[model samples]
Target: MVKGKLHSIETFGSVDGPGIRTVFFMQGCPARCLYCHNPDSWKMSDGRETDIDELLHRAKRGMPYYGNNGGVTFSGGEPMLQGEFLIEAMKRFKEVGINTAIDTSGTYYDKNTRGVIEQADLLLLDIKHTDSEKFTELTACKQDPLFKVIEDIKEFNKPIWIRQVIVPGINDSKEYIESLNEFIKDFKTVENIELLGYHKMAIDKYKKLGMEYKLDGVPEMGKEVMEELRALVRFPGKEMKKAC
Candidate 1:
């Protein structure tokens, strides 16, 4: 039985994915994104270890809600870190006719990870920055896996929602936005593009965890800026048209 290290679970999370999602935040991430909200999930040691059977039992309770456009979402630190567990859990969800989605930073990509993601109905792939240099600086991870993740999603013909976090001064340049638009052009599976505004709500978490807050003086991202980005990168595919 494959067991996953779980950070937490959100019963009715509205923002992570489509519908009223039951988000399972899996533990462990290779990327150290400067603005990461769930820093607690970064460490593999911090979460409770559990198996697919236990997770399936919890997911089944939301069956009625699942019928009303709600289903299971696997979020992270980076859910790809627990690929085997996710594969098992998603298999169970598929058996019961539940929708499955994954919110990922795409920091880890391998043959096994590819296999697991092939079962996903929707993928919320986070593109921290369009520029490779800026992405490395922000997340301390390479860009190859991120690109590969996108390519793999396209190969599987799965639906994907490209999520970009608009951090002030980090990746808000007009040049970068154009670059992002071009970068996503090759992907046919991208159904929608979402520009998430930066927030300082996670600063307190950094302080409590005794970690340095990297974006301390940074201002929150505005709605106007988000709209600007959305207009710039009009992704190709069938739009879900539902608000997160």
Candidate 2:
């Protein structure tokens, strides 16, 4: 039996997905975002392990709140890191009539994770940067897995929510917004785009871990700026309406 390494569990998660979801934060991430709040979730060995049966039991306990819209969202350090576990978990979730969601960094792309992507009903993909040049500088790696994953998800024709963290002086320019618009418009399955304002809510965690927080002086992204970008991008799919 394949067991998943879990960092933590939230019984009532509202922002992760639809309705009220039971969120499972899996351990390990391939990319290191500058504004990651849960820096502690970076290590794979730091988490506890559990198989699908036990995890499904705990998640089932929250079914009352899940109702029609809510279900289970597997977020992470990059949920795709545990592809096998996610595949098995999604299978069980489907059997129990539970909606499955994945919150990933769009980093991992392989045969093992392909099934994980196909199984989930919803996807929360983090788009760090639209430009490949800036992407390498931001994530510290140059693998364009997001592009591949975007294409793969499009093939499945599943609903995906693309999330972009508007970092100050990094990805907030008008040029970048236009670039993002061009990149995402090709996807036929994008339901909505989430323009998340950057915030340094993880500085304290870095302090505790004795690691240097990269965006030390960067201020929190304002809603006004985010609205501006939203207007600029004007996500094209489905009448090119506003994002949620």
Candidate 3:
């Protein structure tokens, strides 16, 4: 049985994908976003080992709540780290008639990983920063891999929900948002863009783990600023939900 290091599982996760769903927060991530809430998921060797059958069994229990829109979503610490493992699990989920989705940074795409990603029913792609230097600054990671994934997935015409963390001062400028909007035009499969406001909800989690919260003094992005950022994402007739 193929196993993956898992951080935790949310039996009834509503935010990861459409409808009510089972969300798996698998272990490991390549990026270190300044505002990451689940820093605990960064370490691959620390999480519990989970098997595909076990995850599917748990998913089965949530089938009733899944309704028509609900199903299974694989999130992380970057699920792409364990792409092949998830491919087998996702294939099983599909065999069982469950809708499959992946919440990924889209940076780990390759032949094997892309093959699995191609099989997902939906993709919740985290669009960190568009500017390569700024992207590296924000996530402490490169952007080329993610761009490649985006390019590769476009050929399949699969729906993708672009998720971006709107950090105040760092990426809230109108110019920056305009640039992002321009860049987003390249994606034909994007269903919508969800701009998440920055918050300090993870300070306590960082403190508990004996890690210094880098953005400790940073105030949460206020409603007014969020609204301003929200206004810039509108693309004529394109479907979108702003300032989430």
Candidate 4:
């Protein structure tokens, strides 16, 4: 049986998707986002190898709380890195009436990854930075693959929630937010856009892991300011709508 490297599991996650979800943080990622909280999930070998049946069984434990909207979310260290496994895993979940979602950095894609995309019921994709240079500086990866995968998403007509981390001094500006609104204007399938407040909560995680906390001195995004910036995003149907 094909197995996936799992970083962790959250039994009742509220923020990742529509409702209460069983979130699977798959291990391994190509992007090195400077403010990432789960830095330990970056290496696949660091994870516990788990098969699909076991994952489904564990996820089902949260079924009663899932209600109509809640289900499973395949998160990261970029879940797309384990594309083949995800393809099979998502299939198994859907066969049992569970709604499946993928929360990805949009950094990786290929044939198998495309299968993962095609099978997913919803997607939470991060648009790290719209500009190529800034995107590379933020993620240490090119923005090309994400763009390519987005084209496929368009073809598949997948429902997606676009997310961006609102780092205080980095990408927290009216100009940038407006640009973001313009960027996704053509994505009719966009269910909503989320501007997540960047926080320093990951510093301790870095300290424990002995990894350098790249955004060490940056302050967490304030709610008031985040609200102000969120108002600037003007996608047609989802203007300022929060991820449900």
Candidate 5:
């Protein structure tokens, strides 16, 4: 029986992937990201054990809502942390004529993780920071693995949607966007770039979980600034669409 540590499920998610989809928040993560909202999902033991068959049934039930562009997305604490289960589950979902996607931190890689990424139809990659020093400071993990994953994604020619959380004082500059533009210039598979406005909504979650909220004093990024940042991401010749 192929089983996965399941944190939670969103039956109709619009943001994670194309159209409306079933989003699975799988358990466990290697990176201790400072801005992580789901502190509770860090432990693999805390998640419920879910059988692949059962998950397939649940996805099938939502087929009506998931039109052509929509299907299933395996999101996480880091979906690749449970690589074996993800590979199998993705396979099962695809067998049933469902398109599959993965929302990953791109921080873990192995044979299983490679297989998982290769199997996915679409990928939502979270870029914590473009600068190596800042990336390590923010996630408390080396950035090499993420680059390695991106290399593999390039090798496999996988379509990717890049997402980044824009912190007010930290990376809210045209310089940062320019660097990001350079960083993604080589990625022919990039579909769009989504700049998420940093918010303090997770402070309550951290408090309830008895964890320190690192960005407690940082004010949320407003719509005006977000729009400004979005505008800057549209470089002269690049066709990438700016998303919030």
Candidate 6:
């Protein structure tokens, strides 16, 4: 049986994907983003181990809510870290006519990862920072893998929602948004760009976990600023909708 280390599962999460959905918070992540809310999930062995069958059973309980617009979303700790488990779970969901989505950092792309992602109906690809040097400094991870994943997504012809967390001084720059707009212009599969407002909601989580909260002093991004950043993306006016 294929199993994965899991941090936890949210039965009725509205933010991770379309409509109402069940979000599987899989364990382990390669990126060390300074503002990561779920620092507990970064450790590969920190969570419980579970198999696909059990997860599917839990998913079925929410079938009534899933209906046509909602389904399952595999979030992280980077779901791609457990590619084998994710692939099996995704296949099972599809067999049952579930709409599947993945919220990933795209920090661990490879042949195996690509294969699993190709099966997803939608992808919430997180772009940490557009500037490679700043991104490396912030997350201590390479952007190459993320770019590669985007390239593969283009080839696979899958719908993708590009998500970016707007850290005040880290990634919320006009230049970075302009660069991203140019970088993604050739990829016709991009359906939306979500500008996530930065918040310190995870500071308490970091404190409880005994990890230093680096952005403790940083205030959450205001609505006006978020709107400004959204304009920079230049996504069609009709597609610019706030995600809560």
lDDT: which candidate is best?
4
Q: TM-scores, in order shown?
A: 0.93, 0.94, 0.94, 0.95, 0.95, 0.93
Candidate 1, position 232, lDDT? 65
lDDT of 6 by residue, 95-196 (tens): 998889999897887657888878899999898877788789888898898888887788899888888888887767778777777666776777778889
- lDDT (CA) per prediction: 0.85, 0.85, 0.85, 0.89, 0.88, 0.85
Q: List the residue pairs that clash in candidate 4.
A: none
> Which 10-residue window in model 6 sums to the lowest lDDT?
234-243
C-alpha-based local distance difference test score of model 2 = 0.85
Model 2 lDDT at residue 13? 96
RMSD of each: 4.0, 2.6, 3.1, 3.3, 3.0, 3.7
Superposition TM-score, candidate 4 onto the true structure = 0.95
Q: Could you tell me the lDDT of residue 122 within candidate 5?
A: 93
lDDT of 3 by residue, 18-93 (tens): 8999999999988898999899999898889999888989999999999998899999998988888988998899
| Segments of candidate 3 deviating more than 4 angstroms | 235-244
- lDDT string for model 1 (76-132, tens) is 989998888888889989998889998889788866789777988899999987778
Name the regions of candidate 2 deviating beyond 4 angstroms: 238-244
Model 4 spans > 4 angstroms off: 237-244
**Global CA lDDT computed for model 4:** 0.89
The TM-score between candidate 1 and the true structure equals: 0.93
User: How far off is residue 233 in model 3, in Å?
Assistant: 0.6
For residues 1-244, could you state the per-residue lDDT of candidate 2 as single tens digits?
9988999999999989888999999999888877888988989999898789987998899998898889999999889889888998999989999899999887777776678888999998888887777787788756577777777788888788888889889888778888888878877777778888888888888999999999999998888888888888656554555569
Q: Residue 127: error of model 1 in Å?
A: 0.6
Clashes of each: 0, 0, 0, 0, 0, 0
Candidates 3 and 5, the one with greater TM-score: 5
